[model samples]
Target: MTNADKKILKRLKKEDKKALTELYDSYWEILFLSSYNILKEREVCEEIIQDVFIDLWHNRAKLQIKISLKAYLYACTRYKVFAQIRKQKAIKVELFDDLKKRFQYTNPETKMMDKELVYQIEKTISTLPKKCRIVYKLSRNRQMSHKEIAEKLSISTKTVENHIGNALRVLKKSLGYTFSILFL
Candidate 1:
């Protein structure tokens, strides 16, 4: 770790909120730029930075610093951005498979199964509040980041994030049982 990072770590270890704020201020732009480059969305970049800070603060006591804070934060942001991309790719693949199955079979039994899956997806989505649904759709379908969605929808980035969290929670609850059957 750099001397500056060591100093910040020392202060942070003592539970200094000001040090945490300073750390954030010091690295936010660098982390944002790194995330923006990978995700190509400003809103997502901001959200990634926010999450990094939250994680850092919440897990401060448990964190062991072996690298410069800047390097560590950049690494964290890169991983999160890549993880989000992977999730989007997986969702797209699942949707594509569903579409393929829908087209390949004319048997009534298979058709009914396909219809049920579609209905489940639609039903889970329909349970979301209007804004959450729109946010989820834009993020998943349009591949827009939270920053882009917030800007387009005229809402705060935090609000965009909350909507996404709510949507995911609802989807997870709705699909939790199905996931085990489908995967196993």
Candidate 2:
């Protein structure tokens, strides 16, 4: 850690509210930008930054300081972004299911076909190797870039790309006929 970081940590450890406020003032913009880049939502990014400081305040005693404070704060923001994305994805899935049910009431035949398509997709996903499944889900479902997936999974970016490629190949092969109808 840098000398400035050491001083900030020392002051924070002593429960100096002015030190904490100064730290936030100094780093808030950078942290906000980082969170906004990852989350792409203004309000959510603001909330994540707020949560990061809250977490730092709550867990200051347990925090270790082997790395630069900026790096630590960036990591915390990244994790919060991922958590927010996951929550949003879960909500989207629920909303999609609800829409499907509503659509079913209007068109039984279309609903049946939609159900079959979802089943086929699920079966194809189930056939993927474990790591491929995870990489594919993170890329497609969570809308994460290869670098983000790599960081989250603690794998190399190249490895994340390769897994995503393999998963896509398998999916294309399994669903080629159906995909042709949809695309072509």
Candidate 3:
């Protein structure tokens, strides 16, 4: 690590706010660009950068750095970017499902086709690993919050999010965009 970074880390560990400001000034642009390159959303990138720093400060006292500060910050930014992507995807999926529910299929042919699609979706969901299937059904069918599902299943919220993401990916791949979005 550079002498400059070592100094920053020392002050940060001491809960010095100026040290945080210095770190932010030095790394914000690079970190913002790193996240933006993946997410392509300026405001979201800014929020992710802010979150990284906030978390850094929150955990600063016990923080352990086996790598340079820059590398650690970059890793945190990348992780937050991926999480934002997953959150956005989940929102899109929920929006599509909501819209589908609001539109009733009145015609017999349309209703029959909808039933077939739903059946296929169910079949694909059943193919998921047991824990994943349970997590997914709780989230979708029961409309359980991640926290609720985690508590009910005795798992962490992050694990619940991962299972839902995995289920969506598999369903989207097996059923294609139109079917998966509508039925999933």
Best model per lDDT: 3
- Tell me the deviation in Å of residue 65 in model 3: 0.6
Per-residue lDDT of model 1, residues 72-168, tens digit only: 5655655576566666674554434443343224344334433554466568889899999999999977879999999999999999999988887
User: What lDDT does candidate 3 reach at residue 92?
Assistant: 52
Model 1 TM-score (2 dp): 0.48
Q: What is the per-residue lDDT of model 3 for residues 144-168, given as tens digits with 9 covering 90 to 100?
A: 9999999999999999999999999
How high is the lDDT of residue 25 in model 2?
A: 95
112-154, model 2: which lDDT tens digit per residue? 4345555656688789899989998898777799999999999
Model 2 residue runs over 4 Å out of place are: 90-184
Q: What are the TM-scores, per candidate, against the unseen true structure? A: 0.48, 0.49, 0.49
Worst 10 residues of 3 by lDDT: 101-110
Evaluate candidate 3 by giving its C-alpha RMSD to the native, one decimal: 16.5
Angstrom error at residue 111, model 1: 52
